[model samples]
Target: MARAPTTADAFNAVAEPRRRDILNYLALAERSVSEIVDALEMEQPSVSKHLRVLKDVGLVDARREGRQMLYRVNALAIRPLWEWTTTFERLWRHQLVKVKENAEKKTNL
Candidate 1:
């Protein structure tokens, strides 16, 4: 299947590790472009480019805060991605339960 453009959806935008990093950082608190650049140790232009994609996909929102642009995660826009990933939550829980059972049996033996 053709890969969707990063701007097409929150999932696609976050598929890039650096973009995910930006989102994770913003999840803690809103940050200016320079702050994101500093936290991620990424070049300003690269951070800006990823931020543009994230903003385009609605995963991020930006507002002018004085002279700087502050970016933050849009939780509502990210809900779809969260919902999709959580579909596997039950499956993960089941597998973890089995592992725990096996470990208990070994310890008791």
Candidate 2:
């Protein structure tokens, strides 16, 4: 089967570690490309590439501010990814409970 392009959806777009890092940074506040490059210690071109992919997938929004372009995460566009991951939250909680019970049993023995 053919693999989907990173720009195809939020999932594919965020699959890249760099893209995730970009999103995390943008989560805090909107920033210019140079700000991201300096903060993340990445090359300007690389950051720009990742931002383009994220924007194409609607995971991010970019606007011209003065002479530079500022980028920010689009929370609404991330809803599907958030909803999907949350489904696993219950499983994680259940596993944690089981682990805690096992630890208590060992401690009491």
Candidate 3:
């Protein structure tokens, strides 16, 4: 049996440039696995592997439509990423303020 991918695993998987491209495409609309493969010009198996991870992490949803399995972004999973990132936004702003102050001091010297 395979262990299910966690949220960290899902985010890490998409840290790959190509995998991020896949998510960007899915962001526009739901797609069949074939559509993703053709759009990315990548191997079907590789695309499938990424999709499996996405699904496991609740970042993507999959459903069988007749002979095809369709996939779409999971809004819930992406929501947490937004919530998590917002915390860092405040921290970065504070750091930037300090950096700007240091830069001004150096320029005066």
For TM-score, the strongest prediction is 2
Which parts of model 2 have CA positions greater than 4 angstroms off? none
The runs of at least 3 residues in candidate 1 whose Cα sits more than 4 Å from the true structure, single-residue gaps closed, are: none
| TM-score: model 2 vs. ground truth | 0.91
What is the model-wide C-alpha lDDT for candidate 3? 0.82
Candidate 3 residues 69-106, lDDT tens each? 99998777777667879989989999999999999999
Number of the top lDDT candidate: 2
Better of 2 and 3 by lDDT: 2
What C-alpha lDDT does candidate 2 achieve relative to the native structure? 0.94
Residue-wise lDDT of candidate 1 within 35-55, one digit each (tens)?
998889999999989989988
How well does candidate 2 score on lDDT at residue 107? 100
- Candidate 2 lDDT tens digits, 16-91: 9988999999999999999999999999999999999999989999999899999999989999988999999999
| Clashing residue pairs found in predicted model 3 | none
How far residue 58's Cα lies from its native spot in candidate 1, in Å, is 0.3
Q: What are the RMSD figures for all models against the true structure?
A: 1.6, 1.2, 3.5
Off by over 4 Å in 3: 1-17, 102-109
Span of ten consecutive residues with least summed lDDT in model 3:
1-10
